[model samples]
Target: MLRQDLAAIVRAGFSAAAAGRLLERALAPGDALPDGALRVIAAGKASSSMAEAARGLLGSRIRGGLVVSPEPRSVPSPFEAIAGGHPMPTTGSEQAGRRALALAASLQADETLVVLLSGGASALMAVPAAGVALDDKRATTDRLLRAGADIHALNTVRKHLSAIKGGWLAASAPCACRAFAISDVVGDDLSVIASGPTVADSSTFSEAADVLRRFGEEAAYPGAVVARLAKGARGDVPETPKPGDPRLVRAASAVIGGRRDAMDGAAREAGTLGYHVVWIDDPVVGEARIAALLHLRGVVARADGVARPTCIVSSGETTVRVIGDGKGGRNQEFALALAAPLASLGGAAAAASAGTDGIDGPTDAAGAVVDQTTVERARAAGLSPDTFLDHNNAYAFYNNAYAFFAALGDLILTGPTDTNVGDLQIILLA
Candidate 1:
């Protein structure tokens, strides 16, 4: 029953129909460029699907462009494959970044640029700012991830340090541009997803400097990098295309997919299963353990006096502050923390959690599902959830208990889901 419920939640969010509809809304037929007017250039996890949808809408009128994503074994017409890194920047990311830049620069003055963007675009479409080497950007990105910085903060620093981010791509285009964004950030900050290749950024260099001071590597930034940011802050380097920038007057953007969509899907499925569903807002942030506690509190509040089964559905990215020398991702840490808490609550209700993408952190498992039995089981094995969490080993804790859940048990793994809209978490109170 527990597995069935969790599976239903996963299926609800990832359907061919919903994905297609989102693509249609993101690239409405009328929004397509006029005959021989559009040049498509895109990158991200969902770029493939988004590109396919664009080609479908535009047909022979579409001008071909490059797309960077995890390798799609099955080729779709009109989408070229350029595999790149995710969650971590790599050398391949650098190559794709350059290609994206060259493509954007190639747009004719009379043409329209249609860019397909989503999460992972930052790394998959990396183009370092003037003085920063690709390696430097990679180092900084890795540091930010390890530091547990949220997407917005991490992207702020990334935009300042990259030539392609912070609306630089749009500004560089020789023609009007429109970006179709699948927002993974909580608030759908256009500038954060892939560092806002098509949208303007409001964060200043000083702000980026402050983020570095707070959680970034100030000394690690290349000397030239530091000077460029300082210059940009002083209005010399050109602020990322702003609202009224002539270039953006004809440019537009829309978020076609996000945590909200994921939650809505889960809620509908849960409702059909005779479970009361409660969906929190999409942008929930903060430390993973604390977030887990908050989620548990909500469930407790509803379950205390209710007789009908309840399922708490949430979709958002959370941060995990890595302190110990352990291995796990934010989702794993969240599940481990929640497991102990739910067990302590001592109810008949079971719990399940997962990353919709089927992979969390460095581990292969998406996340975990626990019930009152998890804590007691772990304790009997002389393994404390708290101890594993302290060591940043949530994967270890949950895997040993036979509770970790990944899509199709990771055998049918889609690797990186090409598109990221944070995470989908469904906590069953039945």
Candidate 2:
């Protein structure tokens, strides 16, 4: 019997949301000096929500501000909200970028600047550098994403080509900037948060060029972008401000949430469900399939060693090298791969993988869950897990079992959750 506990599923789905709430709780009015004259500026996937949180803390004292974020513009925030394109820069994103830069440039020395940053900020809050067009930036971003470039590499190139990223916004603002960030990348490197608009950058132009060349995407990127890097590498264009630079002297940054937060909550919930909890690690980044394979091997080993009910918990962003035109994200891909390996073990325990953010890759569902019987069920339905895994079509495979696997409510969902820490995977070896 494939017993589905709707409440448990909902609990798992809401765990990430609970983590997001915890992040917002860490922000206090005392964190930022209540000078009644701070100019708020934020950008990223969660920038809007973070801005809203700050606004609630600041109340009517805010001296006006601007936020650049993905569109289908969020509800009227206390401050001005400007929606922009994401994963790729568009004309609207360019306009929002200008507005953000203008807002930063207008800040006075006496005015404190509050910056809210999160993932997706790089593409959403894009401001093209000199001689770079929006179309060119979009094309370059598309190429990098398709080539399976990791987040760090993609953002490195993005920062160098942007007018606002790589600490330009901080440099533009004369006011002392205080950054409140939601970290999405592993290690929580500030430079990776929305490409580090308010924080100092350590990446060099030559490194940016190297990433493109290594990915075989050098030719796909704009010639102008490449030329600019070459010039910057030769010292014509100034490097980004490093740590301890005078510009960063008055700046402040804090990470309120991350992958571990989600993972911890999920582990707790699994324990409550009568499973022996096993916490792996949070923010486990790398190739999705390999991670899945390793996880399966561990689960199989553990299952063989004990008769006690057990569950394994892990969190991290995984990458999928798109070899074909397929529809799926890392979490989905991971789940599909796990199903293949778990099929060899055979049993009734269920394993579910999900993105803490709810939306995994371009798919609507957060991820998928499969039991030992799922493979035979899939085979009976004429669905070949191995065949689809090769094509990166996990979404399609799960869609066929939507009644079961896809019913898992997403932790990442609509409405601003005010956070982005990455994915969380849980395997209940009952």
Candidate 3:
């Protein structure tokens, strides 16, 4: 029963249908468009759905389009769909990037270009700047991911290394352009969302270099990448367009969906389930395990204050600094860390943490669920959560625990949710 309720809550929170509706509302009719052809370029996990919404609204106006996603999905005939890579850029991603650039360049000054940007666009539409090999870019991205860099830091570096990111895509187009984004980063900063392909970038090459130095990964970066950043910082290479640049005068962007929308959806579902809802307004950030403990403390406090059943919902992306060679994502680590504290809460508490996109880190599982029985079940199976967590293997821990505690329904699996809004977490006290 607990598992069902939690799943329902998560589903309510990240429904692709709901996201499509929200996108439709954000791009409702009467939004001004230049009196010419409309070309669409959609990229990221939510690209297909966002394109579909755009099609519904501006069907006849959309002349041709392209969408780049981690996997192919059915899209309108006018829009060519290509499968790209995520977490790392692949040859297909390079091809998609080239196609996007060509499409953008094809636009006349009288035409309009609509870019649907969302999470995963950074890798899905990879286009390295001159002199940076794809392999080098991939290696740099891998190092950054392993080093547990936040999205902002990751995009800061990515924008500098890319030919089409950080407003370059917008600059290439002579036509009027607008980008609608489903932000996965904290604060919904346009410059960081999918590297802000159609928006002006305020970050600089020097700042990108600083991010590498701050993360202690500067030495590990590919030599060519380091050289490129250094050159750009020294003004040997042009910087990404900044605010008020003429290249960005015709470009505009709006965030159509994000963490706040997902949180509200979850809150409404919790209330409908007869639980008093407490919304955690602060965005959850930092190391996954530490954030888990902090979130547990908040849950306990809320539980103490309420007489009736209560539900707590919080949203934000968290990082897992990879000290352990374990195979898990931030959401998995978070759920694992919560097990002990939740077990201490006695029998009336259950909690869940999951990525809204349905895939957490490199693992197939979105995240995990835990209750008082989780820790006990692990013991019965001769499993040590600490040992698994120490190895950074939350996926293995949950996989083993799920085998022993099948009734607990600990693994939350929703394949390729096709939308990203960071992550959503819920704690229920009854």
Candidate 4:
């Protein structure tokens, strides 16, 4: 029940009212647009909710806008909403990217362009650089991701390959551009969020090429992508907008919400549920399975002499190497990895790791949870935890265990929170 309550807390923190509250705060320091002509461009997983909040706040002040999201617009929206691809760009993504550039280019000196950015915008808006085909760009991005390159390396490559990313979109506007982002990355890097369309980029073309080479996949990328990077490195093409560029003088941005907010929400719910909340301040990082092992060792030792029931909570994203042909995201893997160690606790304790956005990788479920009995229950159902972990098929294990795992926190399946803030983990112990 605590696990289910944690899911509800995540939903509440996903923020309809909280988004408005944030926008109201974000508007305080910015200069007003006297022309009453506000143009809003929202992109990524939380694009629709953020756009709606902006509309509610700006009202008649907003003259026009665009929303690029992974899902189709539900209709009756004031902005030109396009259903864009995520994790990969589609034709709709290309259309949205082109229109975004045109929209920024059309802005006058007195007008304002508000960019609502979040996670997935990098793929949701992909306008390749000159001479680079979208397919080539897509292929390159896929290779980088599959290589398990970190976000810094990923965005370095992404910014260099695209025309709209890395502050180019903001530079195109003659008017003031302000961005409000729901950060989904650790450390809330402004330049990494949505590839920083409204923030100056410090990455160089040479650095982008280095990322591909560092991952040993430089030659694996499509030819056009490889050629473009080489050209930029050789000074044949211009670099992304750098800091202090005159064009970006009027551009500014802020992180409105993120994983920290979700983390705090979980802590609050735990406290309300009558447990002493203990926070795991360090961000969850590295391979999902390894991280799970470390957490188990640390927390289980700490639970030895607790006088009160406790809720241990932490947040951050972890990566998966994906060596096998299995179906699972990092969160699912994290939770599944805990089953073995958690059984050692020998109490009514449960732990869960889930994406705040409620979608894990390519699967329909958000993530999974495991208790002391999870391993025993799964084995009774004719499953092998080690075998699943070996194949990296955490999702399949959880799915196959569904019949026997009912109400044991098997999944946290909150569909489309319309927000992204990384992932969360909660462990309740007595």
Candidate 5:
């Protein structure tokens, strides 16, 4: 019963519908565009939902626009939605990027541009900078990701190498521009969300270069990618717009939802279920497995004076360094890391970690659930959690190889919440 309840609570907080409702309210008409029509561009995993919200509020006032999404679909008659690559950019992504830039450039001085952004947009709307090949950019992106670069660091490199990121999109338009976002990063920094296409960037090419160097990936990146950063850092190429740039004076941005919303939603649902809630606000970061160990220690310590039926909630994004050839995301790795430790503790508890977007890595399942008996079950089923974990094969541990989690009905499979606010974890103790 607690396992089912745990999944339900996580769902209540990470609901795409709830996130969509927030977007609809944020898109409410503030004022009419005097003397001109309005144009819009929505990007990221939440692209279609955001575009739909804007259409409901603005109607014919919107002239036409593009929605760069991770999936293909039809929005309204005037708006076109194209499936772009995620975690990597594809030809469709390039088309979206160019179309987005052209759309922004078409805005007249009296007209306005409304940019809707969310997670995955950085890759979906990627337009390589001058002389930078899309293939090279893709290779660099893959390298940084596998090297475990955080969102801030990853976006820093992306901003400098992109034609439409790091305030470049906003700078290209002379008309007044406003951006609304659903953040999937820590602190909800507007400039980091979707690499801040419509928000001014303070990060520099130098920082981007440093990120590559820090990860020991500088030399391995494509020569053009390397040369572009070198040129941008050396001022041979123009840098992305910085803070207080005149070109960005016409643009404004806001973050409407993020990890905090996921946490708050979980807390509310846990309370309604008659559990005393304990929230750990410190963000979970760093290596996925290590973060899980740290999180487990914190939860166990909190159980000291707490009442029974306690729900411990926290949400943050983490990175997974792909050392082993395996299939799983950070959240899956995170959940797998907890199995042995919690089994050793032997308590009446159930823990679940999942992405709000209903995806973890390349897997169809959002995440997985683990209980004290998880390790025991696996051992009896001729499986080893540590072996699966060491190979970064958490998905196999949960689904494919033995399908232990599937057998227990603990694998979380909520398809495409279409909202990105990082990941949520719930530990219910009774």
Candidate 6:
């Protein structure tokens, strides 16, 4: 019963149709565009759905556009769709970047460019700056991700090394540009979402360099990236646009969907299921393992004196420092880390952590669900949860742990949710 409630909550929180409705309301008829030809350029997981919402409102006004996504989807419009890489940029990502730039540049003073931005745009629309190779940029991103750098820190450096990010795309166009974003960042800082392709970036090269050094990743970053950042920090290169930059005069950005929306949705679903909803006010961040422990403690605290079933929900993106060369994303690692504590609850509780985007780490599973019985079941199946946690192999552990989780329908799998609002964690106490 708890598993079913969790699944319902996840589904309600990540419904593409619901996301579209929110977008449509936010972009009431003719609000996003003016009386001119519209060229839409959408990027990230929610690109296609967001674009479709625009199409529903502004039919033939969308002359031509492009949508860059991590997977293929049928776009019922004239926009060209391209599959780009995510988590890391690839050659296709470079090509998509060029295409988006070209589309932005093609806009005349009388036309409007509508950019739909989302979580993975930094990678899906990758254009390395001059003298910086794509491989170098890719390597830098990979290293920072493995180092457990947050999105803000990762994009701070990326904004300095890219051609399209940090308001460059907006500066390149001659006409007015408006960006609609579905934020996946903790604070919903427009400049950090998808690296702020159309918004002014307040981060500087010196700060980017500081982030690398602070994270102990400077030595491991690609040589070209390091040199470029150093040169920029020394003021040898121009900085990204700051607040009130003239180049961003005609560009406006607003977030249409975010973590709060997902949280509300989950809360409503839990309430409908007759569970007392306990909203966790703190945003989930920092190390995955630590976040898991903190969340577990919160659940235990909320479980006290509860006469009815209760659901606790929190939302935010967490980081995973790759200590072991294991295969799991932050969500999976978080779930794995909770095994011991959940076991201590003795079947009275269950929790799930998963990326709303339908992918976790590099694995196919979205995330895992664990209860008090999980550790015992694993032990009975000759598996050790501690060993997997040490190896950071949550995906493998969940997949091979006697199929108990699978048989219970605990593994949350929703393919490429077509939207992202960071990660959602749900804990049910009975």
Judging by lDDT against the true structure, name the best candidate.
3
Clash count of each predicted structure: 3, 4, 1, 0, 0, 0
Model 3: per-residue lDDT, tens digit, 94-131?
A: 99999999999999888999998889999999899999
lDDT of each: 0.72, 0.72, 0.87, 0.82, 0.86, 0.85
Q: Could you give candidate 2's per-residue lDDT for residues 316-396 as a string of tens digits?
A: 788888886687578778877777666666555666676555567777666666666777777887888877778887777
Superposed by TM-score, candidate 4 places the C-alpha of residue 398 at a distance from the truth, in angstroms, of: 1.1
Q: Candidate 4 residues 1-430, lDDT tens each?
A: 6556655555544442244455556665545333447888999888887788778777887878899999898632469988889888988899999999999999878898989887899999989889988888788877776666777788999998899999999999999988988888888999998889999999999999989898776668888888988999999999999999999998888898877787787777677778787778778887899989898788766656765677777888887777788875888899889988888876777888888777888888888888888888889889998898887899988888676665565877778777788888888886
Which pairs of residues collide in model 6? none
As for lDDT, the candidate ahead, 1 or 6, is: 6
Assess candidate 4 and give its TM-score to the true structure. Answer: 0.94
Error (Å) of candidate 5 at residue 305 is 1.0
Please give the lDDT score at residue 382 for candidate 6. 84
Worst 10 residues of 3 by lDDT: 400-409
Q: Which ten contiguous residues of candidate 5 have the minimum total lDDT?
A: 27-36
Give the clashing pairs for model 2.
283-315, 284-316, 357-412, 358-412
- Expressed as tens digits, the lDDT of each residue in 186-220 for candidate 5 is 88899899999987788888889899998875679
Q: Which of 1 and 3 is ahead in TM-score?
A: 3
TM-score of every candidate relative to the true structure: 0.91, 0.90, 0.97, 0.94, 0.96, 0.96
What's the TM for model 3?
0.97
Supply candidate 6's per-residue lDDT for 286.
82
